[model samples]
Structures are given as structure tokens and as C-alpha cells.
Target: MAWELATSCTNQRVVGSSQIQNEAMQIGRKEIKLNTTSRAYVDPDRINELKTISSESFDLSKLIRLCEELNICFAGECYLSMVMLTRAILDHVPPIFGSSSFQQVANNYSGAKSFKEAMQNLENSSRKISDYYLHSQIRKSESLPNVTQIDFSNNVDFLLSEVIRLLKK
Candidate 1:
């Protein structure tokens, strides 16, 4: 039955740049176009896990807990999940420049202006990595590279300590 439906589509053609074709699948009286655009490696379950304890301002203990979760994700080879969590962790530390933007968070932070600038640099760098993981459909047909050990170790450590320091002042 499935093969009949597949071969019945005579109008199927490779359109646009994507190798995937937007062909219509007919089921009874309903004909729906299949979404050929592949998605990135985002795991909904991991997203839910990250969202559970997410907050605008995390204390020392909560930061530790989040780090543990991140470590688990890294070990499990869930790189996209880990990157999303990394961005969340960065954004969770509050006191941004009257906004929640990553640049704002990095810019108007509680630490020294120079230190904040450094954080912004890190934020910008990580954002690229996140975007790469985000529009992952580009790599849908290709062999994906292996996810390395997430380096949030130092970045998270530094950000948490700095936030703690800022809170003290």
C-alpha cells in the first residue's frame, strides 16, 4: 500500500536547492504536503529537562546542579542538547543591560566592564556554535561530525563564580 502511494506521485520533482522534494501525500480525501526540510538535532526531552530548573538568577548550588546535568548530557553525546543548555545557563545569570539578550547579559554584567566584555566575547563565540546546532537541517543529508566534550567546564565555572561575586557586592 505504501509503495503504491509512493510510486503514484508522478509530479514529484527536485525543486529548489534542497535535495528533498515537497511532494503531496494523499491519504483518503486528505492530501498533505510532506515537509522535506530536515530539522536540527534538538531533543525535546532534553529541552524539557533543561527547562525544569531554569531561572533568571541561579545561586551556587543550583549552578552546580545544572553543571551536573550538563555533564550528563555531554557524556551521553547529546551535543545539541548540551549547547542549548549552555546558552540557557549563560542567559540564566541575570543583571543584564536592562534586557535578556546574550550581548546585554555579557555587557552590563556585575563584574568589571572589561570582564563583562570578555564574557561578551565568549557569548558571541558560543552563539555561533549554538546557531550551527540550531539550523542543523543543513547537515541533514551529510554525515555529521562527532560531538566533542562540551567545554562549558571552564566557562560555566567562571560565569558562576563571577555571578556569585557580583551578588556579594
Candidate 2:
């Protein structure tokens, strides 16, 4: 499904641009149009659910417990799930790429000779990732709202502004 969508869209980068365009054209006489409204058509109920989950307060100990229960490494899906769990407990923690603090938590847990050490380590990692997500990505994205606007000029600022905007949300 994803491959079809990628191949059927002009905006997507699917290998060589010319080859993709050619293939898309060959598939049909009409050119494939990009579906740029996916993000705009967000469901209000889902948004509300996200808000409810994202605004909850996270407990470090709870994460450790869940990790133990799941018996999963905090590297791939486990890390992403942990991030979601954290977001459910903390609204300010944006779901930015690489924003998950699972590594820090894992590190602390491993280094801990006592409960306090583990707690402190988790707290430190969580704080760091949270600060990076909220201040850097969120702030930059908000500071520029016209990111979706594309330009063919040397004005890189315009492109960056849009990139920042997407990151913020």
C-alpha cells in the first residue's frame, strides 16, 4: 500500500525523479497528483484522544515496570511505545523523531546499584529528551508557520520555516 501510494504521488521521492515521473505517466495518461491534505483532515475525536493521552503525567517507575513486563528492548518498537507512554503522562513531551528517552532510562536502570540511582537516571534522561523536544523542535516549528509553502528561489529560509512548522506539531 505504501509503495503504491509513494509511486502514485508526484511529491514523494521514490528513487530517481525522472523515472518515477515516467512510470507514473506510463501507468496512466494523467499525471499522479499529490495528496497533501492528509494532515489537514485530522479527526477531532482522535485529536481529543491524543490530547487526553498526551496530557497525562508520566511516572518513571511505571515505565520500568512496563518494560519489565513486556520483556522488550528499549531500542525499536519498545522505545516508541515508551515514548507514547511518556506522552500519555506528559503533555509537553512532543513526539519528535529521536525524542524518546528510552536509552537514558535503560542506561540508568543498568547502572543502578540501588533504587535511587535508577530513579535519578531515568529522571535525568527524561528531562533531557523533554527539554530538547519542547524547546528545540516545538519552538522552532511554531516560530515559522508557513512551512508548507514551497519556493524555487535561493531562499532556504522559506523551506526551513516550513520544516520547522511541521516539526512543531
TM-score of each: 0.51, 0.22
Task: State the C-alpha lDDT per candidate.
Answer: 0.47, 0.30
**What is the alpha-carbon RMSD of candidate 1 to the true structure?**
16.0
- Tens-place lDDT digits, model 2, residues 56-147: 23423332222221112111112333333333332222232123543443343332255334334434544454444445643434432121
Q: What is the lDDT of residue 35 in candidate 1?
A: 24
Q: What's the CA error at residue 119 for candidate 2, in Å?
A: 0.4
Best candidate according to lDDT: 1
TM-score of 1: 0.51
Residue pair clashes in candidate 2: 56-89, 57-89, 58-89, 141-164, 147-162
Candidate 1 lDDT over 25-103, as tens digits, reads 1223222222211111222233333334434554344444455445444334456666777777676655423456667
Report the number of clashing residue pairs per model.
0, 5
Residue 113 of model 1, lDDT score: 76
